[model samples]
Target: MTAQNLLVELFVEELPPKALKKLGDAFASVLADQLKAQGLAPDEAVVTAYASPRRLAAHVTGVLARAEDKAVSQKLMPVSVGLDASGQPTSALLKRLGALGTDASAVAGLKRAPDGKAEALFYESVAPGAALAAGLQKALDEALAKLPIPKVMSYQLETDCELPGWTSVNFVRPAHGLVALHGSTVVPVKALGLASGNTTHGHRFEAAVSPVVLKDADSYAVTLQGDGAVIASFAERKAEIARQLAAAAAKVGGGCQPIEDDALLEEVTALVERPNVLICEFEAQFLGVPQECLILTMKANQKYFPLLDAAGKLTNKFLVVSNISPSDASAVIGGNERVVRPRLADAKFFFDQDRKKTLASRVEGLGKVVYHNKLGTQGERTERVRAIARAIGQQLGGDVLAKSADTAAQLAKTDLLTDMVGEFPELQGIMGGYYARHDGLTEDIAFAIEDHYKPRFAGDELPRNLTGVVVALADKLETLVGMFGIGNLPTGDKDPFALRRHALGIIRMLVERNLDVPLGSLLSTAIDDGFGDRFDADVQAQTHTSVATFLFERFAGTLQEQGFSAPQVSSIRFDTSVVLTDVPKRLQAVRTFAALPEAPALAAANKRIGNILKKSEGDVSATVNESALVEQAEKDLFAAMQTTVPAANAKFEAGDYTASLQALAALRAPVDAFFDGVMVNADDPALKANRLGLLKQLHDAMNRVADLSRLAT
Candidate 1:
């Protein structure tokens, strides 16, 4: 009946750095979940997870030694089948009772319950609770089975027998120890061919003791830290590293700060049990290389955090997260500097060698490199992109913009052949910019060539200049149109070409840049220019429509993410002629109009009008014959339209969408009255056509901004 907090730890070889945090979180959560499900832990129990380079552990509070017993009801066969005609126990009933550990003597106690119109016999019993040892073992097994291990390793375990042999075991890493403690008592459980104990090893080199003997669940972290010289909690270790990094950077005393990279910080944290931040520096001569190249080389190859000055320029000084804290830190600093010098040198060498050949000369090598087997070589892809860029630039500006965009697009992918990019593919566009500047190209062209790959991922910034925008648009459009033309559409979550991202990039560029170009025209140009004569005319048309639809769908999702409601977005009818840049204005107008008091009635009336037009057989025109409207309500509605339509049309034409939608609010009363009094399907064909024509006029005037029927609930 008593409750106690529990502690569990798995000691093994170093875990995968990238997967350590996930594994630790999953282990704690799954084990606690299993305990709560089994009634061994309270509903409000607190679970704390700890992970180090060599161990994964969890502490759970309010865990019971054994779960409480529970009453269970089990359904049996129908009463008619279980009993004879006289209501006496039959052989079947006796056999069933025997299987339940009871006999016919107890059959009279069975209760009959209605199950789906038939009476069925039910047997009730009290199920015994699971003991701590068995429950913990089951929880441990389930937790291990569900861990998100990136990869598993198979290894042979050491045999206790004198004979030279080994037992094979498969796990994320080889396990040497497991510790399970309930309060201060050890819980006997087995995993990975090892029995649970209260003993676990700590820091390989700095632990004051060989193996830490945990005293209790509450004292696990404190004991580990004091005796083992290890910060057991992953969060605590990361925080300590951050604190030390800040202090070390401050001690360097040049207004220098460590580069803020969460991924690098986490990886470095996962590599050390006790972090000790140390400042080190390479030769100042290495600063001649681009800071990106040097900083990347240090961070990627050496796992060092390069410092930055106040202006955000990389300094020669960097910080290393050392595992050991030695009194004399010179050795550690000297050793790290020596190790990083060669990495920086390699980066410098690549940069210097890549600048030797101009981007123009490297353009020829792209032909040898295949971009996609079906899409042709990178050389052909560049030309396609160039054509698209030139066309787009001309529409946005004059020949000057067009020429700059063309040059940028042509040289954009040439960096794919550079030595720096060959070593680090992530530096492709970056190195291209550097090479372009070195080749004596204008800043605009160089920047365009560098930033053509801008907005590569979600939330990334778009190109800064007009020329860059043109080239970036062209590059993304080429990929989307080319991929969609070949029938390689993204299905479900499998977007191999990242077409969804490319579509979103296009949408962002149009809407955020406020580009005046129609989305349909842009897609058409991309398809026609990129795939010139490669496909039949019909196929090109279909591809254009499909790609445009895809972009609009992505746009709708983005709008919703920006806090616009689904109904608001859906109300705007997206078509080929619809300019994407105008969508935000329309959505804002719809939102404003929907808030007006008269909106609901007008929306409903518009819905009715739309339904009538959809079902009508003949062409419905807005040319209403004035004499045919005989009803007083119809005459009043017509008079109101004559006054309201002109003002709304003027506002719409002036691009004042909100005012246009607001102008229709005055007609709400007239609209409701007409809908109430008028019969659209009149007995006389001419009268019916005239009434339909008046409604058609009303519909057109009300919906120039957006389809109001979509707002009707």
Candidate 2:
């Protein structure tokens, strides 16, 4: 068998920019996988993916013309059934052999094998390998079927018949051409109602030739670039666009650079083939609007990159990635400038109009806006947030902080009534901040309104001020409690309310800010205090437990994701009452305790003590009588704890978790000896009770910081 490089290309109408890269990568990977699974490609085959505005392509190296033949042994039937009594073939055996394109003569060579308890007849044959054409057709079909297309389009195709009839073809886009080549030869394959050929169209308009003919699999990219006037590889096109943007920014001769957004760069790469970076500008008056507003419109609507100065302020100039490289780009620049000016003007208009009314004046409008079907309007939700925030603020700071948080929470969702937010819902909190500042409110209130939605995603920053933190906590808890009360809990990945993110955000704030408030108390206030009549008492208690459990589970997952070992994270018995602020420190202390020389013995002994106490028939009290300790091992352990437990308790109370766990290491020898020499369930009832009490004391002390038993393995 001979091996050769392979090329596959599918040309269609413009693809959805956001989904192009994923589709291309999936197509190449799945196709290569299918080929390899069929033995038509080696395990070490190299695959390259190419995608553009109008084409998806892949080049795989070291593909065989046909897969190698395989030797197969298949069980036919029970030997007893196939061969009657003696050594004669039965009618059933003859019929089975006929189905395999063989006759009675072939039964002489059949082998006998045992299947389970009974002996069975086995048929041995050599299965011929699939040719490249058939293997590639299967691979191509699988690849297309597996692509992560955002949406599919159905179009009619004209069949090649004496009387041509329209046939419908469904794909991500209308397929126009397909190219499949092995070395320099075309492979016979069909897909999307089109036969595979060695030619493809590229660049729509700028292509130097129509129906660009590919010479070979190895030369596809080079030939396409030279004659098709296109850059076939998505990565190369993206890098080229980036290089051009940087160079164009440098040519502007100021301390200015294009705003860095990877998603924007990727989308623009997919929107063009031969990227020609051109500088365009809008009026400087638009800079009076917030840079976020301007940047959002440009990237979201026009897919343009906004320029930023050394001060990180939006500049009047921006960069455009044009597909065509015209000799003089003044017209292109002017056209883009003309197109963006109105968008900037609209933003300015919205900003100016939104400031005419203070956030407080718009509070009544939220009553009409629905928040959730079960949970009243946004107005009602706002009131609940205010109550929760006030409660949190009183605990964190005094009455003064409570007043600020209440005010901030009251006006937080007012921006939803503003035209600016109506046009862009992502700017709800941000626009409210601007309006608050305009209304002569304090920066504290303004920033809190802006930051109440902070940590909206993982790795995002938390609120900058105490007021902001208090409000953010209140808002997240309200949603968590409300949704859980309604049984809208997230299942797997279908988090319509983004409950997972909300839970993680709460965990981040509690842990990072080191807030001292109990998680259970916050859920309690949100359910009972804030949402008074919304949910019944039973629902409140259940929601509190459910939300608390959800938060802790998310927190534990976060700790594990941050590189903590599973056992370490699991060591902390997280529950509704566990203070998240103390978890990181406890985990660190556990890590330190695990490294001690006596840690293994202590951990194993602690595990044994736990099991013994669990198996006790009745409740075991930690209070042990010194007079009842007859065994020398128990006496030694009690004596050791008399000195050690006090010191460890003092360290634990002082928040020196590491010191506390380390102090218990001194009892490792005594604990090991006690377990080895003394039976917890003694013959005498008093002795058993005393031993159980002593073991309970040791278990409680060892597990205060973390369950050392978890570290046993």
Candidate 3:
């Protein structure tokens, strides 16, 4: 049994709950990796991470007492400097002579030095130790100290240093102290100048000013409870929150679900030192605004959860979680209600004012604002989006969004001119949607008005409506084309325009929406639209290819994120580099193709085919004359290819790349036979031409699927 454990906590003013939730998981992953790197194995374990607005804490259990012992060895040179009769280290023999401690004879055999400066070195040393605790602690400290915090504070200790805090130890919040223990004994952590000590504290509001001394990790929770805090583990927090939320909901009315505000729940969990649930309500008139509007106002403005009634209607009721237990609970409820109503009222007013103007009536406003310094006005962008959206809509077999998309694109950014959207830039599409609907535009246009910014994050909702997808793609393409046209392309980590995210957003839209338009055509048209007269055809091709390659790499990354390895994705995702709509199928092909144990052999044969074809220098037109065949293997391989061609093309055309590769897989046997039995060095040039032609034909056939020869085993 191991008696070691690690407990870590970082104090900050207040952390957002979403970030706080991922922090614990990320920390555990990195910590576990560090532990394994130190060669330590622990038994049953527990790591509890809790976050309050003010602090983030973690307690790890079942840690080992020390890192496993390790051996360190230093290599000694086997040879002395190979010196010539001149007594100098020979340039040619220097590498052969090991560093120092080389052979005495080898040194003596070298040309003797007058000063005898050429002596062999002493041998190397080896050491072994019981535990690498120092190394482990150092690594742990480095990782913890560098843990990324989105925001930080000012420090008095290290003024010049970038870390935020008043103390010399710059931390995200403040590193008031640390407590490192191994089986109830302080381990004396002096790392990063924040030494481990005999004491720690409970939730700031709960145990206020009290020190907590825990015997071990298992008892840490007990100590927290005694000090009025809940150990903030996701499992524990979720279970408790769910239980309390359900019980609270049951009392009000049966079948009430805790509003599905995981983000809200997470934040509240961290905001409270002790977890408690309460139900409150505001005036129901606020519900007159869109439910989404109300929710965002509550979430972004008030940090409250908007509960839903039994019939799934937005209720005026909300759930407030307070950290401190005040004497009069209704006073707290009244206070929160007081804070939220004004924000909601402002939102309602914006909704009312925005609806007063027809969306089409405001289209002229788009031309007044500039989207980019060089890329013309927002009206120009809208024109480009309209053109592209119409194209995408046509492909989706809908003329509805084709018109609505064009309309939405024309007016999407017009909302930027509105006072409401000007005040809250993040509300561009949202405000547009409300105003468009108010203007009595079709629901399709109204939906597209808001849906253009979709898939804002990974796993975020995508545009489900056809018109929305059209405008979304149009908007993204305009951004990509316009940015690339103006030479504002992303380089390294510096993307001033967020072009990468915009490109990724476009890809996710294509993949999730299953839009089937050829990415090449779309980009080509986009390039033509943006730089029709500005650049020569050569320049356009270069730009198009660059944009295509960028999109392809991002698409490949998308595949990789979905559990595909680089090699597997690279092989199939290579030249098939069309649009994201094609990735799922291509990824499927890569997986199926790689699954064949014979892939290596097939790859080898394909390489030969490519090399042979290249060496033939575009002479595939040379016909294979049966009589010109000098060896049966050459004749047989030629015959096999003739049979494989039609089937390969058919299967490939049917999107059965898996079956196509399978058909090609059959070539392994005949390909081996042909290579083994045929010698292309026949006296007859016709036979040579015939053989080369056959190889060229086979190579061209495979290239249609992908450049398999580029794959690594």
- The alpha-carbon deviation from the true structure for residue 387 of candidate 3, after best TM-score superposition, in angstroms, is 3.0
Residue pairs with colliding backbones in model 1 are none
Clashing pairs in 3: 52-270, 87-111, 153-164, 154-165, 155-165, 155-166, 156-166, 157-168
* Model 3: per-residue Cα lDDT over 424-469, one tens digit each: 6778788788888777787888888887888676677887687887
Please write out the lDDT profile of model 1 over residues 55-84, one tens digit for every residue.
999999999999999898888789999999
Question: Against the hidden reference, what TM-scores do the models get?
Answer: 0.98, 0.98, 0.78
- Deviation in Å, model 2, residue 625 alpha carbon: 2.2
Candidate 2's error at 365, in angstroms?
A: 1.3
Please give the clash total of every predicted structure, in order: 0, 0, 8
Sliding window of 10 residues with minimal summed lDDT for model 1: 527-536
Q: What is the clash count of model 2?
A: 0
